[model samples]
Target: MRRWLVLGALLVLVLLVLAPFALIVLNAVKTPQEYAGSGPLSWPSHVSLDGIRAFWTRVDFGRKLWNSAVISGAVAVLGVLFSLLNAYALGIGRIRGRHWVLAAFLLANLVPQEALIYPLYYLARQVDLYDTRLAIVIVFTAIQSAFGTFLLTGVLAEFPPELLDAAAIDGAGRLRTLVRVVAPVSRPTLGVLGTFFFVWTWNELFIPLIFLISNDRQTVPVALGVLQGDRMMDATATSASALLGIAPAVLFFLVFQRTLTRGVTAGALK
Candidate 1:
């Protein structure tokens, strides 16, 4: 009975979390007149493609999707690589002032983006990187790697001495050991971090909106967000926009969920 009650409670929580998304799916199919007649919760009288078509065409969603994917993917790869190198030095090399270094990374991570954007924008402009997707990738790689460095530092600091000893006996150098041993062992953790970096970069709005003024260069979130105030989009179209904005992220999460699960399980076992 207790187990059944726990399951029931979990089911209810899941429903609560999903309720808005379910409504979005419903609203996306609803005509504005039908929604006005029967209300948001009522069954749609008929499926309508108008909202979806309008939002998709207006936003040039395909271009936004490609831009988001490129930026997020680059950030994920660069962030993870940079984090791994930083953690390796701090965690394994026993570098001097390591704690202070880790502390710096932590403090950097603690600072909000709002506090740093002005300096970052200035730096971007000085380098002629302003208003570019490459700028977004570079900015977020640095930002995201700050947190990833702190995280990977802790995980790698606890790495097994026996594994290191075995690699040493095999005449492996630092790079070889990292590539052949430590990296493989830490694959799950890296996967989790990469997924996080990708998702966070994909959902970013404020910085991208500020940086990328050109409509053709805007990311998914920025494009959808800028459209929120337009009189051309009604409530149903707004819902459709929301769905379009979130669908890629949802699909990415589902694809990487196994990696996330493995990372959690490995952490638990350790």
Candidate 2:
């Protein structure tokens, strides 16, 4: 009875999570007139691609998508690389005050981006990086690295000591052991960090809105915000753009789904 109840609760939670996305997909196919006439939850009588067409033609979607891809991709790759090194040093190396270092990383993660945006903006402007993709990429990488270090630290800490011992006995130094041995074993954890950073950066709007003053330079989330205001009366176009904005993140999650699961569950047995 307890197991059945748990399963039923999970089913409800899943439905609650997926309900909004289902509405977006359903409404995205409707014509603007039909969408406005019918409710957002109502199914369309006939499918139309007009909303999707308008989303592409009426907006600089390709450029926005490319900008988002560049920023998110850079953040994911650079953030993971920095986090791995930080975790290795703190989690595996014989360093003094490593616990305090880990605590600092966790504290950095706790500091909300909203609280630091003003300082970051001032610093970016002072450095002549304001309103540039490079600025956002640097900010995203730093923010994501904090959380990544927090996660990867635990994973690296749980790594078998014997493996490192074996590598050392084979005349492999710290860098070579990390590259040839530790990295191969930590692929699942790395996948989780990369997917998380990519999706977070992809969906971020506030920071980009504050920094990227030009519409042409903004990310997809900022572009979608602009689209929402411009197409307030056109529900179908809004739905279409929202769906388009999230598709890449969804696809990325699907591709790395297994690895993410493995990475999250790895510490359970240890």
Residue-wise C-alpha lDDT for candidate 1, range 1-270, written one tens digit per residue: 999999999999999999999999999999999888888899997899899998889889899999999999999999999999999999988799999999999999989889989999999999999989999998999999999999999999999999999999999999999999999999999999999999999999989999999888999999987898666788899999999888999999999999999988997885
The list of candidate 1 runs beyond 4 A from truth reads: none
Per-residue accuracy of model 2 over 1-270 as CA lDDT, tens digit each: 999999999999999999999999999999877877878877899999888888977778899989999999999999999999999998898479988888898899899889999999999999999999999999989899989988888878888999999999999999999999998889878988898899999999899989998878988999888767664537788889988998989998998899899988866755
Q: TM-score of the candidate numbered 2?
A: 0.92
Clashes of each: 0, 0
| Alpha-carbon shift of residue 232 in model 2 (angstroms) | 4.7
TM-score of each candidate structure, all chains considered together: 0.98, 0.92
Indicate which candidate wins on TM-score: 1
Reference-based lDDT, residue 17, model 2: 100
Cα lDDT for residue 130, candidate 1: 94
